[model samples]
Target: MPEGQVITVTGPRPVSALGVVDAHDHLLIDSPGMPGQGFADVALSTVEARDGVASGITTLVEMTPIGLGRNPAGLRAISKHSGLAIIAASGFHRDAHYPAGSWVYDAPVELLRDRIVTDLTRGMHPADWHDPSLPLDEARAGAIKGGASYHHISHAERRRLEAIGAASAATGAAVLVHTEIGTAAHEIVDLLEAAGATTDRIALAHLDRNPDWELHAEVAARGVTLEYDTIGRTKYHPDSVVLDLIERVAAAGHLDRIVLGLDLGARSYLRAYDGGPGMRYLMTAFVPRLRRRLGDDAVARILIANPARLYAMPVAGGAASPG
Candidate 1:
């Protein structure tokens, strides 16, 4: 692997080698908590990544962590078959995504840290389900993700965040945290920094849903990356609304701290499920809108430069080791 390489599911490649990147996305999301026909399909994911490549997206960050059906082998297959640089996540999502009494809730901090560290260094098969027959996965994680609940960070989530922070500090992998409606963004940063995580290596996802310029500027001033991923979903806000927010943040002199994502997790967001806009929506549509609004230089920063820098692991080889 080369220096300044971005870790993919297959291996690490140079940052300059990457083209455009979707900073936050869930290539496949399958948990017991997700509906049966909601949005978990390898075939669909293959098309998603492949189609994005057609429109100039060279990389994708898969934000589905452990306990959320983070199919590492599935991700590897998608990357192999699609020829896309895919980065898999290792950590926990919101507590509601898991069943009651799951190990994520009750596991000791050291245990959680070791599990995430192994996923980063060695492989990404999370559990055996009390059965000895299941095998470990060969695909390794490129990033770590953790999250809190609505309006409050629970004790369990905090413990997991601390463990995730420790794993990140050890591995130098970027941290993607789910902010419930964008609350506790600063608090999350404080906790990760307290646990020895790097502020520049942290990306707070879904803050665009909240759409607060002052707050976003505040967080970006702290050296954290902000990912605005809810594009093409008119149910939220128009694409221009997000573009406007980006303009505000850029004008605040924090342009380097910004990134983008498609966040096409829902079944309806999939073209295979008649989700028309598809994964190319960002590269094809919103990016053009951004270019028109913010010029090609800013476009390059958000889609190419920002993500490559943020997602690069501290110790780069192929997969990062917890050394």
Candidate 2:
């Protein structure tokens, strides 16, 4: 298999630079069980592929292949075209979010683990992806993902948790978990730790929605990075709430254990409250303001260093330039 040009992992490659890396973002993810052309954004705009870089985001990790219905060929083409270090993912979203019995939930835990290991070691395929000639491990994917649902935890949630845990133990790929709204945060953390996964490589997404200071503190203390993904203050939680959570985490002195991503998808319309166009909160508003308030060093730790460290991507180069 031919490898694409090796750009600096963080931002675009430079002789001496550590690029700006988005710890998590869904550049291509759409509704589950749907094809790429069927997705609203993919159908409507070519902008979807390069939006992250255009928005001053240099590197991005697309959340899941299943949800986006992405094609590896298309993903590679997009990455080549955009010049962004586009890290991709394998594994399923929560059972309820997509098909109930999909790979993440219904498959026997060990099988799912093997599939994830294979994808990580190799690469993933869409429903039609069946090429015997391709190398699986060198497929250029980054992490394994699993989710807890939006409103409530389902009966089958534990199975997904166990599957994620097993996959993490089997392969050292990072785990990106979507926790249930409000109450399921600590339970997910305990589940992963109990399953013998290390806290350093695990990231718990959507913590701003729950707003539990103690849980945030505990997870951060354990060296697990918390993702405050609800960047555009539309749809779910308030902007103030999001800011409060960040402040709380910073005050707890766990600033190094935080990662930022918008969590926007191709299908989901931008909510009215979303600091529209350009993801203003992240680039225009949040980064500048946080730099002013927290100082340059703190901002770097929260936004840049923390994410690079959390993802375990290389960071030996110099400071990353603004996108």
Candidate 3:
């Protein structure tokens, strides 16, 4: 609608109003990749969202892509009930999330691009395009989501990424690409760039999973934002590892390119579901520690300024209206 505004599930909001953002997270997601871990209850999701708000988060970027049980209407309900600005995602994940012979796997690049543009401009399909005749939900997706396999981009994944890049170029929306354990960073950037999406519009999610400061610095230098969301996943590595990576990257003059999130994408990761390190963990535990290590100004940039800039929709001349 306007420059410096982000399209939330409910409507468009200025980036300045988005305080203490969790740049990457999920409200409701059901996928075959993680059996029995999907959480779809609206009330339960609202409860978890309230926990995030109470812990100082004002906005959450719900990163559940298409064909992965994206509940746009439910997300709008949760946003209303929880008082959180929710930015839903459109586009596709890696091919692994889709069943064999699913439309997502066989759809040509044009159909995939149209679906994403429709979600961003008109509204998200209530059934995620399973039934095209179904009415569109009022909650439009504010960002595009794409994914790559472990150190590889399959034929289908590449096609989806191309669609994502095209949609992003057409709508001037930000894109969040899911990198498998942080692999294929350069390749993902190259493909999206070649497809017409600028590096500034692209963010590589879960880059912390790899935790290689040298690689991160190189990517950041290319003007691509780096999203670190493995905040409490001790199985990956201690928080110290990410903290060290951030410090190193910041020292390399790329602090502004950094953003943070908890990315609790499962039911078991929510306190409402009796899980550890729930949505509040980012603000209640990790952030205070981050502030102690890097002063308030630095933490503010990470939690506030950086995400605001990264997620804001560009004011393209022919961009689709946020209907």
Candidate 4:
């Protein structure tokens, strides 16, 4: 809101201060139900932060949204311990991530918005959110994380999406949408925009998994940020694939709308848990390759400038106009 201001775990700071940001990633994530998908850095300790900071990221966004082990206190500790600015997520994840009889089943959209806004403006409740007796942590959220379905958004998911839109509009926080393997990205943007979230502050995550350069161009043309994570996940594809996709979108004049992150939420991904590539792989491995291929300008945009713009909140009383 202030000149070049962006939200961080340490509170507001100038965008210039947030150097080499990992646009999307997780810290202190302890999600259950995904038996095959656990990670080494569940608590996001000083050790993980040391390696991650050594690798290159100045700011790493934690994307484990509310009700799913979204540890705000842990995020603040990691940022302080690692000396890396960490931004936390508020809002909801994929529908399958929640239980059938959970709050999503009966909580009205307005209630969802209220809770999200409270977390963003005030402080986050403990990750074990089902218990009302637990106290809220002082650390606040910086962004709203929303998830869409694989191909089409389900009705339950729509409620979350609408609530995310309402919360973002009310608080001026960025709406980070998780597009499952990049499916239904356009529709996700349309839905958020229709519900009062401005396209300028909306970001779509994991689009690189889809590899549709044309689709990226189309989405970016409409004013939303494209977050192409999956940087070092070789199983998804070679790093060259993501590099090529970035180059294509850059050539199409959508570079400003492009951001980068490593959504390493699994135990197999973090080196701290004996995983292959750690959180800092982007700065340590990918950036060197990116520099050799796309040069420094590309490196700066994907790692720094773009992330700052995408994460910055709009000024209060100066609401962003819907496009």
Candidate 5:
């Protein structure tokens, strides 16, 4: 693979090709943690993805980690059908997303680390590593996904984080960590850094759930990206809250560290399922408002330039194999 390219399901492409990105989102996810809420239909996903594309999104970073219904082959099909660049994830989610007797809970650090590296450099396991004998999917995972508990990191979660950090260190892949309601932001970064992942390659998802500008500014100052995906999530708070936080963070001189996404992670969150906001909400609804508040240059940076930097695979050895 060449330098300064993003590893998408279709194959590697130049960073410049990723125009206007949704830095965090999910196209296929099925987890016991959210009962009866998983969406796996590739046709519906392609429909939703096309809507997003029509609304001005060029790429989507699918953050459904392993064992949480991450279908790489299905993602590839959706990408081809929808004309959307999809960057898949490899790693694990929080403890709640896995079952009590699942192998993810007991897998050692080395096994977990190798799985992630294989997903990045080789291909993601079609069965999410449930059956390693199965052939690998042609679509490769471009980024790593890991999560922490609410203000705490469990034993299993800690092990997974260690593995994620090691894989990131070895491959120079970007990592996206799910922060529960935005808790343990600094602590998550600390552990990943201690495990050899650099702050620049780390992004804390759902940081807007906390909505603390001071904390966001501090984290951004540390060279870590802050992903705000609460757009149109009225259940959490109004879009104004996120807008205010972005303005404050930008004022604090960390605008370059901010990225935006809708994070429509559930079936009910998609318009194809007769849901509200859908994937188009970010670009069609909130982005116009964001442009009014911050002007086109800042919005372009948030929607385009920042994601290009955050999701770009390291221009070094260890990136995923070309599809």
Candidate 6:
């Protein structure tokens, strides 16, 4: 197979390619004035991305463009360059991206909702941070993401959540929330349910941060997929917390309710910074350790089976045995 080239999912089952879909990855994310990262092919080479894809990553959900100042053209270019099924997102992030005087900050809830719905219904042009002349159509985005960062508790943040709720209700696109503090996951669930967004259409991101196994269960019971995406364990948290939560969630007989991801971004400085582990941690450290502890079947359930169901991807890829 050629590097950076996509192969059709042509297995006997309805799915193709390798068995992993990285549900959360920031292929190109940067603040303003930084030239961004996704467009600079040399910065994080598409070759590296291809290498990762070759290592079982069949699909990658890039989630930084719309609100983090990601450019649609760059995303399209990178998608073409990588040749993987790159699913991009369209939505708003926190105030840092919105800033104080930005239009996104003061936009009415309905206006924001319209933008999200339009993007979901249409598509997005994911170039660089401020690239002009990007198209907004459906061929670009596969879903919409709403939350970004667990920082401030501002009206803008709340409005973004409301917009996300409204967009999800209107478009039926799956939502990924960046849980704020300890309240974001629960609060988002409430707001979405109140707005009549089904739990299955929502994913509770970073449920491992709060570490309340019971709360995790509650979120799962609502039919929402609790994304256990702390795969980069050494970053932002201790390995013990990741291990503990995994065991706790599994021991509670709810292993089927989890989805796994590394949550890596282009801006992350794992090799430079001492606090975080790089993106390869999942396929390298986590998977082997998971198999060692939980056996091959349990590992397969979390890595393969659960994520497919969570993302609504075809589960008939390799086999159909229930987890």
Q: Write the per-residue lDDT of candidate 4 for residues 13-126, one digit (tens) a residue.
A: 777788888889876666654666654343445677778888777788888887677767667777777788888888898787777788865789987887788777767777
Summarize candidate 1's per-residue lDDT along 115-160 as a digit string, tens digits.
Answer: 8887788777645222324665777788889898878899999999
In model 5, the runs with Cα more than 4 Å from the true position are: 1-3, 316-323
| lDDT of each residue in 57-90, candidate 5, tens digit only | 9999999998988789899999999999999999
Off by over 4 Å in 2: 1-18, 33-46, 49-51, 65-68, 100-105, 128-138, 150-155, 266-281, 313-323
Q: State, as a TM-score between 0 and 1, how close model 2 is to the true structure.
A: 0.79
Write down the worst ten-residue block by lDDT for model 1: 126-135
lDDT of 3 at 141: 89
Q: Which stretches of candidate 3 lie over 4 Å from their true place?
A: 1-3, 316-323
**Best lDDT among the predictions, by candidate number:** 5
TM-score of every model versus the real structure: 0.94, 0.79, 0.97, 0.93, 0.97, 0.79
Residue pairs that clash (backbone atoms under 3 angstroms), model 5: none
User: Which segments of model 6 are wrong by more than 4 Å?
Assistant: 1-18, 32-45, 125-134, 148-153, 233-235, 270-276, 313-323
- 1-323: candidate 6 lDDT, tens digit per residue: 11121112111212233367677766656644234432333335355456556556766666664656555555555556766566667676656555456677777888777666655444454442134355553243445566645644467777877887777666555677767543567677787677657787788777777778988887887787777676665545775677678778888877887777666654443332232455556677677777777788887777766655555422222122211
Model 6: lDDT of residue 300:
73
- Residue-pair clashes per prediction, in order, are 0, 6, 0, 4, 0, 15
Residue 218 shift from truth in candidate 3, angstroms: 0.6
lDDT score for residue 317 of model 2: 22
Instruction: Assess each prediction's global lDDT (C-alpha) against the native.
Output: 0.83, 0.60, 0.90, 0.80, 0.91, 0.60
Residue 282's C-alpha lDDT in candidate 2? 71
